[model samples]
Target: MVPQLRKLTLMRKIKVDIFRKICTNWPNLTCLHVDFRQEMNYSLMKHIFEKCPRIEKLKLWTTMLIDQRCMELLSSLEHLSTLEVLLDKPHLTPVRLRLLTDACPRLKEIHIDWNYFAPQDFEYFLKANKHTLTSATLLWTVGEAQKTSVVPLLKQCSTSLRKLRLVYFDTPRAMETVAFEALGELHSLHELSMQYLSTYEPKLISRAFRPGCLTQLRRLLMQYTTDLLDETVIAISQGCPNLRELRICASYKITDVALSEIHCLRHLEILELSRCSGLSGTAMAYISQLPTLHTLILQFTEDLAKLQPSLRLIVELKELRCLDILKSGNIKAVPFGEFPNRLLKLRELRVTYESENDFTELQRKMPNLKISNTAWLTEDDFPKDDDADYGYRDG
Candidate 1:
């Protein structure tokens, strides 16, 4: 058979050297996901370039070797359009970035997760391939350099960029230090995801959604961004009317007002507001009205009473699919009279309570629904003392 391969995803657990053989066999392979713990030899990597010349989509794991020779080999692959690399010992430098992008003119999506120094040549890479890049994910070791590295890249690629994910690990106030105004300038951007494991400034992030900016944005994900407030939610609801999916996990300041503001987003398909304290029933009422919502996650609410009234309105959501209210203390006992009128499509439901009776009733009534392992959580089980483990999913 002619070597007209297109994609190859291989995870190496064995010590045997089968990868080199596979790469040599597939000369026309376009996409390759190599998640191996073993160190890759230069000759084997070089042979990949020589043999699989058409390898375009490349995703490598954290421990894989990518030395200077490997970079030389990478520079030979001309058809690469998407690249995701998790760097370990040998950090990703701009020189190597330039080498790869210079070789691959069609490279459009670049996702780099590094625990090393911010690549000094980041801006140069952005400038050279700005027109071609539409989706980019840049993650660096925890520090202020993240803002420095990201701000300029966004500025350079503002015109053509459509999707972006910026993560600064264990860095508190990374978002506060960056130029949020630069994000607003990217008019073509449709999807955005921001992750700062330690801390992130939501007010500054909200500034990016002012009126004309991000009007076409469909998806917004801010994991562990606890400062997202009503003001920002209102601004997003106003500016990003086309918003489809929103995830605000472990946010502190968000309340009923914020949900009320975003309830009118007619196009919203998925909403996840987990571990948000200080909410009322009024907010849940607003969420019930979202016409297009398919997946809703309101797990671990501070006040269970606030979520109870909204349970009745949830049945009104004809399109609702997955609902997660686990650890919210909303269901001490399953209410037989207050069951959803029509949950024909409801596939997965998670609740935190120890009751075989509850599970049995739910199963008997809705045979299609999959009630997962009961999360027997008491008030004492709530780890308010440990912020790190507070919202940690049981699964």
Candidate 2:
């Protein structure tokens, strides 16, 4: 008979004994995820690097302050190729951050807590090691000061970067000109995600039109942003001809006009629109015209019932394979009989409802549907959020 193997992960609190056991037994571990709130003891960190010599990827989430001791231990991991650090307190000194890049010479990707360092410290750290960075994610919590610091870094580091995700901490107008100007120069970038500050305005969407800004982009995701009105959407749809996947959530300004402009996206295959209350039946009618769309996610809309009758008109979507509708209020009133009897290529369908009558009706219409009747799907279902100790995940 074969013996069973054991597994361990750092969770709430990493005691010294647990750390010692992990170090002594998991020497060849390739991936390590640690939460500093539970495992803040410096000795455990020292043991991790000294004993787990084969560890190549590390993700650390720290709820407490980071000091020189943690930095020194992190610097000694000779085999680390990817590192993700989320800091609760803004205290990663410029000296320590620079030491991290220098220590891990082969580092290819880095994700840092955007709120942890001052603008000057961030710029200095980026300037020191722009050559080795392949991808970077920044979460900004401060306003214009952070954006000003980040723009110059993006301009300088754009040459080697292939993916960049930025969460703006300030209003749109504060740093639009410089940030977009820098983005126009990133000729090599291919994937981009942006989360605009709450006070973002729609007029600033024109800044993204700067020539070459999105020429190489293949995937784009925008959240809580503005300026997605008719004109801006038309310009983007025409500009990003190579875009294959598009996700726009909580962008309330988009309307039916934006859907009309999407016809220019000839290569698009996936579209996700969640909490976009402005989209109506007219928008769905226009979306039905897209021949290449294979996956569609419509979630948390206030008036999904109104669009239900239009479903039959779009049933000709030959490539459509997956449909997900969850948390959309009053969706029970939508008539399932309006849909075509045979969705020949449909492989997956997810629907969430509040009433049993709605579930029974939907099951009668689509007997093979996978129905989940939860009031809400919390962060616990996803492995990433359940495991993260310090990094914030948007709902």
RMSD of 1: 6.0
Pairs of residues at least 3 apart in sequence or in different chains that clash in candidate 2: 14-38, 202-227
Model 2 — which ten-residue stretch has the worst lDDT?
A: 382-391
Residue-level lDDT tens digits of model 1 in 266-351: 89998988887756666667887898898887777755666666646677677877777877664642243334456567777877
Models 1 onward score TM values of 0.82, 0.82
Give the alpha carbon lDDT tens digit for every residue of 162-204 in model 2.
8776653452466665666666567677777665434355555
Clashing pairs in 1: 226-251
Report every candidate's CA lDDT: 0.67, 0.63
Query: Scored by Cα lDDT, where does model 2 land?
Result: 0.63
